[model samples]
Every structure is written in structure tokens, then in C-alpha cells.
Target: MKEFIDYLLKFGDLNEQQISCITANAVETELRKDAYFAEAGKVVRQTGFMTEGILRNYYYNSKGEEITKYFVEENNVVICKASFDNEIPATSYLQAVTDCRLIIFPKKNWEEISGTVMIWDSLMQKIISRALVRKVERISPLVSQDATTRYLEFLEHYPGLANRVPLSYIASYLGITQQSLSRIRKNIR
Candidate 1:
């Protein structure tokens, strides 16, 4: 909860009372590895602040293969913005890549806090803007880089994430086969 508060503080100011109300409305939850935090075709009913571990946003391709879109590591917000804001079924799945701890607020509580707190909406806007920029920066290289360069950039950008997540997931994110990723890894070593 403290970590979550600290993250929020980076985006905007909040008084003790406001902080208290925000914390009171949130619940701490654990998601086991391989569990789905939010699933495709289901409304995203909660927003979470990740305190530990990683979650991957993915979707099934036309061939029914899972294509990893991105990863949300500890100290990040976990929510499908379009689904959560529009109250519609998600187009992707948010799955725990490892056992995770998160501070979560149900949609109702989130809206209530926004309504009651004057700065809440603006703070959220700032956070969302930062997230969108980071997403674009992270994704841009994948479009032009080759497999090995993409893998290297992934290592440089995420820093230690290569070893933390499954290679299959990393491969999926890089648009390559697991075998190819393995070969790249071996050759790099």
C-alpha cells in the first residue's frame, strides 16, 4: 500500500485524508502464476497497482497462438484502459507471469474516489499519458529491428526481465519462435 501511495505521489499530490480514503477503498490481493487477472471477452472490473511480480497482456492470434503484447512489472499500474473506462469486454488477457501481489480497487471504488477527490482525474490522466508514451517507446523498436537486435533491445530496456519471464513469452513478444530465441540466446552467450 505504501508503494502504491508513493507511486501515486509521483503523479500528483494527495493529502493524508485523501490517501487514507484511497487506501481504505483498495484491497490487497494475490494472483498466482498462470492465473488470469483479467480475461479476454470479460469486463475489466478492477484497477491494480502491482507490488510484486509480473503480468503479461496477451491475445490469441488468428492461428490461435498467444501473442504477448506487453508486460507490467512490479511498481506499475495494471489495467486495460479501454475496457475499464468504457465498461466493455477486454480484447486481451492480463495474466500473471509470476505469483503477484497487488493493491486493487474495484471500478465502483475507483469512480467513487475520482468523484470525491478533486485531483484524482488529472492524476490518472498524467499516469495514463506516461504509460502510453512508454508503451510506444517500447514497441517502436520491434517494428524495425531483427530478432537478435530486438532481443538485445529487450534486455537493455527491461534489464533482467529476460531471465525472470518464460522464454516462450519473450519469444512471443519478439515475434519469433521459442527455438529461434534459444538459438539467439546461445549465440549471444
Candidate 2:
């Protein structure tokens, strides 16, 4: 809860009443490693503020292979806005790569809060805009970079995650085979 408040405060000021309103609808959940916060074909009904651990968003490609799309770590918010906005099922899944603690706001209440609280909508916009920009930045690398370069870029961007995340997931994230990631690791060493 503190983490959520602190993160939002970075984007905009929140008074006690506004904080109370938002917190009133927020719920805390814990997931063991490998648990999923959301799954494909289900509607994503909440926006989560990750307080602890990491999550990966993914989709199965046309070949039925899981392709990792993005990572959400502590202090990050995870939502499938396309689904959330349209009130439809999600096309991807959000799974915990590590045990996680999350403070989440229900989508229905979030809508109301934006109207009730000053700057809530602005804070949300700032948060979502930042997330969109980050999404674009992460996606842009995959098409332009080779596997080894992608791995290096991943390390450059998320240095601490390399050891914590499984090599298989990292390989998927880099759009490379596990054997390829192993070779890259060997070359780096």
C-alpha cells in the first residue's frame, strides 16, 4: 500500500481523502512463484501495483510457442488495458516469475476514483503513458537486434533480473532458443 501511494505521488499529489478513497478499494494478494495473476482468455479486472517480486506478460504465438512480451517488477503496474478498457477477455497472460505481493485496484472503482479524486485521472494518464512508452521501447529492440544483442540489451536494462529470472524465460524474452542463451552466457563469461 505504501509502495502504491509512493509511486502515484511521484506522478501527482494525493491528499489524505483521495488516498483513503483509492485505498478503500485496493486489495492485497500474494502469489507463490509460478502462480498467475491473470491467464489468457480471461478478463483482467484490476490494475496491480507490484510490491514484491516479478511478473512476465506473454502470449502464445501462431506456432503455439509462448513468447514473453514484457516484465513487471516491483513498483510497476500491470494491466491489459485493451481488455480492461473494452471490458473484454485478455489475449495474453500475466504470471509470476517469482513469489509476488500486489496491491490492486479494481477496474470499476478506479473509474469512479478518477472522477472523485482530483488529479487521479492525470496520475493514471501519466502512469499509463509512461507504461506505453516503455512498452514501445521494449518492443522496438526485438525486431532490430540479434539474439546476443537482445540479451545484452536486456542485461543493460534489467541487470538485476538476469540472475533472478529463469534462463528459459529469458531466452523466450530474447526470442532465442535456450541453447542460444547458454552459448551467449558462455561467451560473456
TM-score of each: 0.98, 0.95
What pairs collide in candidate 1? none
Q: Write the per-residue lDDT of candidate 1 for residues 13-110, one digit (tens) a residue.
A: 99998998898899999999999989999999999999999999999999999999999999999989889999999999999999999999999999
Q: Highest lDDT: give the candidate number.
A: 1
Candidate 1, position 115, lDDT? 86
Q: List the residue pairs that clash in candidate 2.
A: none
How well is each residue in 1-189 modelled by candidate 2, as lDDT tens digits? 988999999998889999999888788989899888888898888887899999999999999999998899998988888888888989999999999999887888878787789788788889999999988887799899988888898998776999999998999998899999999999988
Task: For candidate 2, give the lDDT.
Answer: 0.89
Clashes of each: 0, 0
**When superposed on Cα atoms, how far off is each prediction in RMSD?**
0.8, 1.2
